[model samples]
Target: MISHSRRHCVVELQALPARIGQIRRIVSAQLRHWQLDPLIDRAALGVTELLSNVHRHAQPDKTCTVEIEFRLGRLTVSVIDSDPRLPVLREAAMDALETCGRGLALVEALSEAWGARHQTGGPGKVVWFSLTAAPAPVAAPRPVRISSKPVREPARTALVAVDPGAVSAGMSVAASVGARPG
Candidate 1:
């Protein structure tokens, strides 16, 4: 399920493998609707990582709230779960063949800033990351040049066969006839 207001979207769901994919699609669509197409991939990936964390590690329940909000030239994605434990940014080396333990690291590399905190007056924690959003391009006004002098129309010119091309002898004699509107 999803609900939203201006510049914000919230989805409540069980963080199962199947539900995570659906949430990614929802997040992508929301970004596209807001004309933030460029942020779709990053935002979707960040949300996926957060949701996966909830599915893998959260205790007591798999239910979580996914929130995506845009404000002040930044896009923020958060996953709030009932577990109050904040996530740690693991810097320890992992096996080359390891497929897990790198989700948060990827989020950190992709986002401009990211962190987690315990929810105020709640039993859950919100893990969130923020990406810098570029402002939508606005059409710039074209510059106009004004001159005090009156605009001059182009002169019309025609070639006249002066002396009938010098009697067809090719004497290279021609005259230009110019005309101006009355």
Candidate 2:
């Protein structure tokens, strides 16, 4: 039921500070290419937050995969890391003024929906966010000019022979409306 073609991109890299910025750029570029101009900023922010988490908290190593998929008028940006520990969403404390713990909060605010899921048949978990945007408008078909009039075909009736054994009784009853069987 998807009218527009879907797009997917995956980038595997060590979640270093430098690489996070690089992935942000790649995500932005891909969203632009998919004609999702409105989602670029939010998606970039979500990717940055997920990658930052991987860089700071993932175990075994800092390696991770950043995946971006667009389908059904929604864009999903996810990060998969070797750590199975899902991210904890801390409630914002009004008394605390720390700036470090606001990454996921920002992602939650900007995204339509966001969650983390344990990867099946793998050692890692994927943190993802969804953004809804209107699909790109379909281009109008070009108008063609015809120099000659369309030819008309003369109507003729043909007799069609039906085998009672070959056709079901229900089919024969339906075909008897206008069809003449010889």
Candidate 3:
């Protein structure tokens, strides 16, 4: 069951060069508002790559949905597009310096887990990645009292010595004279 505290944000737009940056900023802002600051950079990067893929490859339309969900101590960033093709993760070659094929590679390296799924009963697919957030610190359990006992008061009183000369300047002259010894 999904908890009521779960957070979710979604943006639907054409995955174009201009919209990618706007979506990245939106994703960053949502993560920040959710107090998932550590995930912002990675989430933004992953979303950028996913949207770029949509821009370059999605069929019929470049329109897509970007979704962010925080649940079960994990933050998931996903992009759903009209393209039916699942993404292929190309192995990073030792000497290749191509800029075009590194999107999924970077997503795999940065995310805890990543995958693509064909949308059920639909003509599109959803590509997603998850990052595990550090669990919130559990509050220490408070001590509970099972029974009560009679309280014992101190048997003696402590007397504190006071110096008359050390009294505040607000003291009346007559009161100071009366408090002093000849």
Residue-level lDDT tens digits of model 3 in 117-140: 998788999999999999667799
Q: How would you encode candidate 1's per-residue C-alpha lDDT over 1-182 as one tens digit per residue?
A: 77999899999999999999999999999999888998999999989989999999999999999999999889999899999998987785245776878889889988999999999898989999998888878989989986698879999876563554344665544322232213
**What's model 2's lDDT at 81?**
94
Best by TM-score: 1
Per-prediction CA RMSD (Å): 8.5, 20.7, 9.9
For candidate 2, lDDT tens digit of each residue in 115-161? Answer: 99999899989999999997678899989986998788988877666
The alpha-carbon deviation from the true structure for residue 3 of candidate 1, after best TM-score superposition, in angstroms, is 1.3
RMSD of 3: 9.9
Best by lDDT: 1
Question: RMSD to the native, candidate 2?
Answer: 20.7
Model 2 spans > 4 angstroms off:
1-6, 93-96, 136-182
Candidate ranking under lDDT, highest first, comes to 1, 3, 2
| Higher-scoring candidate on lDDT, 2 or 3 | 3
Instruction: Return the clash pairs for model 2, or none.
Output: none
State which candidate, 1 or 3, has the greater lDDT: 1
